[model samples]
Target: MKSAFIILLAALPFAAAAQTTQAELLRRGELTGTRPSARSQARQTAPRPANTASDPVQQHLLQTDVNLAQASADQLPSLYERFIATTRDERRQWTYPQWDAAGQVLARLNQRYEQVRTTLPLEERLRVRSFQGEFHTLRGARQVKDKLD
Candidate 1:
């Protein structure tokens, strides 16, 4: 039992990482929705003066920004779907309680991921993924070791 507990503690990170990746992707997708499109840019720049404040080029750029904002907003649901899929597919050697705890962690991660998604830069998101992966690996190993004993 002692060993099992230890193992679970260690594997927590892997579970979290898998979960976070899904969440991040979802967030990214949402953010991209509000961004501008390719064709719009070409039209905007074709006839505009380089320095004009109200130039078509500038307006297009602004539109692009708005598109990105819309995209970002759209990303969250996608993330949730992917996250759910990944978790569903991952192999679980965990006991019922361990699994339940893992589920709870996933829930917490989803909540936090959404919160962080609002303002997180790409680099920070990457870090979150790495850390979450490490956590899962450690927790998984601990759980296995305990079970074997």
Candidate 2:
């Protein structure tokens, strides 16, 4: 019994860590590409604020960002039809539980934005109109999963 307890305790950290990593990957969509380093993973998983409509770029990006994360998934082709139909105004409704879920999604996308932000050059960044928009669109894909569940 003692040995079993010890084994279970030993396994706890690994289990917790795996769960954390999975959540981070799902939230940030960092697991899609070739394996990323721990350093990059840490950067990509860093927490970010929920969607804020302060900047035009942020506003437009948030408007269109729905479903961006779903694109990287294997089922993307099947999901595209439904994902494209959800509008920004619908998402922005901000009801109780729905707002909570949307907040989580936006936070995840914000982390993804941080990871990719430096990759763009200044000129290209200017053209981006809040590259965060694309990230939001990707994140928006999760909305369908939510609906099905």
Candidate 3:
């Protein structure tokens, strides 16, 4: 009975540290006491705020940005659609500076979207994500095209 008790006590540490390796265990210190916090484990850093209206380059201020800023939660999808259509149709003619301007405008619009995202329907949220993905793809393609040229 004493031998079994000793075996279990020894096994307890191994069980608790099944995921960790020898090097990690040595570096992180003894896991016998308190575990390290999630905050100390390097969570994703927050994004820095963009300078929209105050941008030094004086970005292309689309009328959609004004409308989107004033829009209610339910109106966002339609406003996004308007912005997407305008950008999609116009992007073929854009230079690097124009693309940069469009990106700044999109960033400003995204800030507005974040404010009311939770209030939107699941379908609208998915649609917005889809729009964002498409815009990123379009922007990447433009960069590639520029590099080729």
Best-fitting candidate, scored by lDDT = 3
Q: Please state the error at residue 80 of candidate 2 in Å.
A: 15
TM-score of each: 0.31, 0.28, 0.56
Candidate 3 ranges beyond 4 A from true positions: 1-67
For residue 65, what is the lDDT in candidate 1?
Answer: 18
Better of 2 and 3 by TM-score: 3
| Local accuracy by lDDT, each model | 0.43, 0.43, 0.58
Candidate 2 regions exceeding 4 Å error are 1-87, 91-94, 123-149
* lDDT per residue (tens digit) for residues 1-149 in model 3: 99999967766544543344534432332121123355423321445444334443232334333444455788767766765777788889888787667665665566566667888888998887677657666776666555445
Q: Candidate 1 lDDT, tens digit per residue, 1-149?
A: 99999977876665554343544433432222123356534543575323222333223322221211133423434443443444444434446564445444343343335444657667656554554454455455555555555
- lDDT of the structure predicted as candidate 3: 0.58
Question: Which of 2 and 3 is the better model by lDDT?
Answer: 3
Per-prediction count of colliding residue pairs? 34, 13, 0
C-alpha lDDT of residue 77 in model 3: 73
The digit string of per-residue lDDT tens for model 2 on 33-141 reads 2346687677647763443434333334244434433223222222222222343446545444654454444454434444454564655444332333433443444
Better of 1 and 3 by TM-score: 3
